[model samples]
Target: MNAPRKLWLWHVPLILLSAIMLLPLWWMVVAAFDPMHALIGGHLTLWPVTWNLKNFVAAWRSQPFGRYYVNSIATTIGIVTLQILTSSLAAYALAFLTFRGKRIIWGMTLLAMMIPVQAIFIPDYLILSQLNWINTYQALILPFAASAFGIFWLHQAFRNVPRALVEAMMMDGASPLTILWQLILPNTRPAVITLAVLNTVFHYGYLFWPLLVTNTAAYRVLPLGLSYFVAQQSGFMQWNLMMAAVLMTVLPMMVLFALAQRYLRAGVMHYGIRG
Candidate 1:
């Protein structure tokens, strides 16, 4: 085959796959803006016949979504910030510092990563309950502040740093914290940003933990708010309104990924090269 022809053939499959993945999202956009009468009349189409703002307005007014947005944003930011700090520090220590039982500690972290969150939920819940943290922001943010996966990911990135640079820093009497913030983190900008973006996306969609810890609207996040909205439509499904809410819930992460796509690509490349 000619080179151009081969390249086109290779790209065809990827293009198809991309379209397949985006089909649902495109449908969501269509459904979100389609008029409720059209939707209820079973007049579904790939493109909206009638586009209006009614769905968005109705979805927003149907529930306390404003509060949900605030709670979700706050908790997600808090979790991602704390995860970066704790993970980077733990990773730096594991990768650079020579300490007793370093292997054991690293092994434990790996084990923690392997264990499912469900397996430890009882213990985590009990600890929070004893501390009287239920139905509070602390319960939502504290349990996930440190992530074993984050530690492992940053540890790998940290190991990619030049050993000579670290040794020279140490010789100049640079403290561990200084080395971490000044050298290691700066060098791993792509990885750190990638982790932050991924963590934010994951925690923003997190429903199970928030559901278990919070019972009131004051602490309810977006995912739970969506659930409540769905449940309220017990017999009849408000597909248009529901999809509008889903779109709003996911729009931020979509914008984030679009903006940081380059960094995400670079981070993935670094991981493959380093590993």
Candidate 2:
């Protein structure tokens, strides 16, 4: 078959656009390893003048990165786990169950998605205070355990399951719970993984709520720890150290995306199945 001539033109602009989007990320990687002099001089080198692991080592030692790392991992996992459970359950019920006010409830849930997080911050802080959960993991993890986007995305994926299959399960004496676990979940792996990736990354950078809720250093996550690093230092920013700190903070998510990029892309498609 002859190639479509216009296809090449379509991709030419897309390639250029992709390069433009990637330039900042490329700069960040280069800047992270540049020598202090090169960094100060603002030279854009494709490769570092001298390669050293000192930035990473210094970043790790400059603060309690070990503890912060552990806390961040734990908190992110906790939130993602709860989100999967709650969002899946809510999505299953919304997608398959017939009940009074189902549409109304679904509408409300979708409406909740439109509300800004900033609007709820005061109420969330007040509730945490009333519960005396300040400086506790509960304060950090509980409120965000269920994401509107996750529920909405999973609901869409669940909607793609054939209605005939659900009817067959019902005729076979399988309850909704059984159908959900055996029928829906097995087919929605991509959507689940995509939501998990998004939820994990979202939690990774979660800062404002943590800063307001956590009063002590021991509970600090990477974002808060980086803030503390900035505050503890004096004079003009130590460009090298700050870049090193930024690299340390961003490394885990980068490693995860690198390892799971294929799965993440598949999941994104699944999540968008209905859309």
Candidate 3:
């Protein structure tokens, strides 16, 4: 077979795998539109028995999903923006600059990465509580202003950049910040996008931190909102409604992933190339 024809043939398995991976999402779509009775019938089926968009409307009206969306979007955006700034600058310093305690600081960062967020939740919560930031956007966004993982990810990408290129820019009178912004960051675009998309998805779906910090609706995020909805429907959840709410909760991340799909693969490949 010719090279192009063979390449086309290779896509068949990938297409099939993609469909397989999408099955649960497809099931959710079918369930979201299925009438409550149809969903509760306990029959195994892949298709919706009937078309009913009311599940979506009912789900929305039953909860303050719009407000939840606003809270989630605002906090997630804040966290991501601050994270990129902190990560890029810290990573640049670690990768290209020399200073006192550099190894010790890098060691600390690596140690921080090994420590899970759950392990630090109590301290984080106490810090927020002490600041009287409970239920505020500050409580939600401040703790994540600097991400250990983000710093590590960008640092790896930065190290892959040739030191000579950075020096050349410096020789021409470029400031470190200028070289970082105008040169290094552009070359590491995939890594940045990959981190942004990942961060968005995580923060958008995060339940535990928001649940711990915020008790009021004003700061409630999507996952916490969904839990409340589930609680409200505990005894007999309308499966269709549940599916609709979940779909709404995850829709943003889905769109984000779809848009950044190419960058994710490229980022992984780029990181793996030299590391």
The number of the candidate with the highest TM-score is 1
Candidate order by decreasing lDDT:
1, 3, 2
RMSD to the native, candidate 2? 2.9
Query: By how many angstroms RMSD does model 1 differ from the true structure?
Result: 2.2
Q: What's the C-alpha lDDT at position 14 in model 2?
A: 94
For 104-170, candidate 1 gives per-residue lDDT tens digits of 9999999889987778888999999999999999999999999999999999999989999999999
RMSD, every candidate, angstroms: 2.2, 2.9, 3.1
Candidate 3 local lDDT, 232-274, one digit each (tens) = 8766668788889999998888888888889988977776453
Candidate 1 lowest-lDDT run of ten: 35-44
Q: In model 1, which regions exceed 4 Å deviation?
A: 1-5, 10-15, 37-40, 272-275
TM-score of each: 0.92, 0.86, 0.89
TM-score of 2: 0.86
Query: Global CA lDDT of candidate 2, please?
Result: 0.84
Model 2, span 118-234: residue lDDT tens: 788998999899999998889889998887877899898898899899989999999888999999999887788888887788899988878999978889999999999888778
